[model samples]
Target: MAEYITEQKRTLKKILEDNCDRAYTVDELFCKMQALYPSKAPGKSTVYRLITHLVNEGAVKRFIKDGERKAAYQIVMGEHCDCHLHLKCTDCGKLIHLNDKISDELLSTVQSTSDFSVNEEATVLFGTCGSCKKHSER
Candidate 1:
């Protein structure tokens, strides 16, 4: 049973890492895991448990998406996630990690003008993504 749990944890981590382009709710992740391992996917409770662990370890970020009551989780892309703001696509649920250079400049400007420090980890700019905008135009 211990070995099985370990394997489940590994599989869940891989799924999040590979799909780092977007955040997923618990139900979404469970369905994805079920699709990948129909016979052996862990239960939804187990998925939540493992996700909590990942969040505690800083390997994943969990946030309440805009205009939603449920929380969503996404894998942290790089080592410096705390140093930059994130952009979340409202249409497709994609999460974009802003480049460090751009993030730094923005942060600097905001600080200089407003004298307020933004919590990068908790800050997410929500908008329609490029793909969604293009598709909508068609």
Candidate 2:
């Protein structure tokens, strides 16, 4: 038989999937969950537990952004968790998945030059996105 997914888990999954472009704090996710399912909203602890479970299962990715007290969580789709650097926008809090030939070249360079193997899963670069930069300049 197929494993049964709980309602709370389904709701949380939907929220993360829907906001894949941005990361959400535990509190923020809780609030959104409550809004979506006020009658059966999971508690804060439950949200945290579920998120942790997802992370361990490789279905979600969690990271701390600069100047943030709480860690943020985002859904991991397909090969995103395996081979891409995440770019986080400081101004808009948008998370962009970067997978380019240059990134591969950089990885090759690092491997060729040193014994250190880059951890792509945990790699993140923070900067203002183009839209945010333009908005700030205007």
Candidate 3:
């Protein structure tokens, strides 16, 4: 049983890491896991448990999607993720890690001009990604 649970956790981690650019709701994750391994897919509760574990470990970021109450999860890109703001594609749900230099400049500018401090870890700019913008232009 422990081995099966560990396997399921590994599978879930792979799914999240492989698609680092996208965020997934719990239901979506559950469905994807089911689709990938019909026989070995973890149950909904198990998926939730694994997600909780990942979030606690700082390997995942959890946030509520815009205009929705349910939360979404995405894989943390690297050790630097906490130091930079993120960009999310509204059209495709892709998450882009902002370059460090640019992020620092932006944050510095905001701090120098306004009294409000931005939380890099929780902040995400939403817009159409380059690929989605190109597709729409066609």
Top of the candidates by TM-score: 3
The TM-score values for the models, in the order shown, are: 0.59, 0.57, 0.60
Q: Tell me which of candidates 1 and 3 scores higher on TM-score.
A: 3
User: Runs in model 1 with CA error above 4 Å?
Assistant: 78-95, 98-138
Lowest lDDT 10-residue stretch of candidate 3: 61-70
| True lDDT of residue 11, candidate 3 | 87
lDDT of 3 by residue, 1-138 (tens): 498888888888889888876778899999999999999988899999999888898788887664467888989775467878889887656578887789989999999999668888889999987877887788
Candidate 2: minimum summed lDDT over ten consecutive residues — where?
1-10
Q: Give each model's whole-structure lDDT.
A: 0.83, 0.78, 0.83
- Estimate the TM-score for candidate 2: 0.57
Clash count, predicted structure 2: 0
Off by over 4 Å in 3: 78-95, 98-138
* Number of backbone-clashing residue pairs for each candidate, in the order shown: 0, 0, 0
lDDT of 2 by residue, 36-99 (tens): 8898888999889888988898788787744566788888664344566678777756678776
Estimate the lDDT of model 1.
0.83
Per-residue CA lDDT of model 1 for 4-121, tens digit only, reads: 8889988888888777667789999999999999999989999999899888987888877554778899887644667788887777566788877899899889999999988878
C-alpha RMSD of each candidate structure in angstroms: 6.3, 6.8, 6.8
Judge candidate 3 against the unseen true structure and give its global Cα lDDT, from 0 to 1.
0.83
